[model samples]
Target: MSAIMSGAISMGILAWIWANLSAAVGVSTWAGFMGTTTYYASGERFIKGWVKGMIANMVGVLWAIICVEVSKVLHVPNIVAIMTGVISFGIVAEAKWKNLSFVPGVYIGCSTTFGMLALNGTYLSTVVALLMGSVVGLLSDAGGELLVRLTNKKETEENLVEKQG
Candidate 1:
């Protein structure tokens, strides 16, 4: 399906950019862009979904970075790196449980955020962003449900008319 294909394309694009683009800007921009694009395919829409998509990815990425940066500073062996990676993966899995945009953002942002977090340590900001992203996804799923109900009802009504006619 297009959803699978889009996910693939998003990953491919991320890889390519990582290889070629500047560390700070590219990661943030592409993660947000791809997250937004991929998030909508489930037919969900929130009043502020776009903002949610951006913040979720940006925050999720930063969270992953926190673990990596701390590990480097504390030099607590490679355990930090391993832990952060696992945590980031886990967060992504949680978000993806319903095919929400948060999953992609968290996955993509964490890898990028690791470096950013190393340099800046904006943990609070990242947390806030992730929360926003979660809200966006929640709204989108709710919206999708409403849309499905409306469409189905309309179809049933049309069929009833045809039958009666």
Candidate 2:
């Protein structure tokens, strides 16, 4: 239930921010932010999960940028992309972000990274947008949690009063 609410909130925030924030940036790059936020909202603890997810997002974004740049520079075809993927796999396999952060940074990293490539977005812009959205998502989640807890507390207090009366 909380997860659903969190996801909804994250999406809603993204939608609201899309017009002003994303327009100023690029939609493609902003989408990476949305993607990471979605993953964060759906997963575990907001702060902790977001931290890990951001780490993964950064890694992925960096890798994708490198891949795209190198691909363009060398005029290499599909092979370079494959090699990058392999390298990503090797890093994740070795580091195991899931255990360390309680979140799958590897998946987030790769998805965000590849997303940037697919959308033909700039690296710095994508990273900025992603990080911005991530911060918004985290705040939204925190705010949502606070509202729910306050509501629950009020309800509980009301129940207690009724029983006493």
Candidate lDDT values, in order: 0.52, 0.63
**Which candidate should be chosen as best, given TM-score against the real structure?**
2
* Candidate 2 global lDDT: 0.63
Q: Which stretches of candidate 2 lie over 4 Å from their true place?
A: 1-20, 24-42, 73-78, 97-104
Q: Report the C-alpha lDDT of model 2 over 10-75, residue by residue, as the tens digit.
A: 557655775576676555535546645644644766777677667666766665666666677785
At residue 81, what lDDT does model 2 achieve?
A: 63
Cα error, residue 68 of model 1, in Å, equals 4.6
RMSD of each: 9.5, 3.8
Against the true structure, what is each candidate's TM-score?
0.41, 0.70
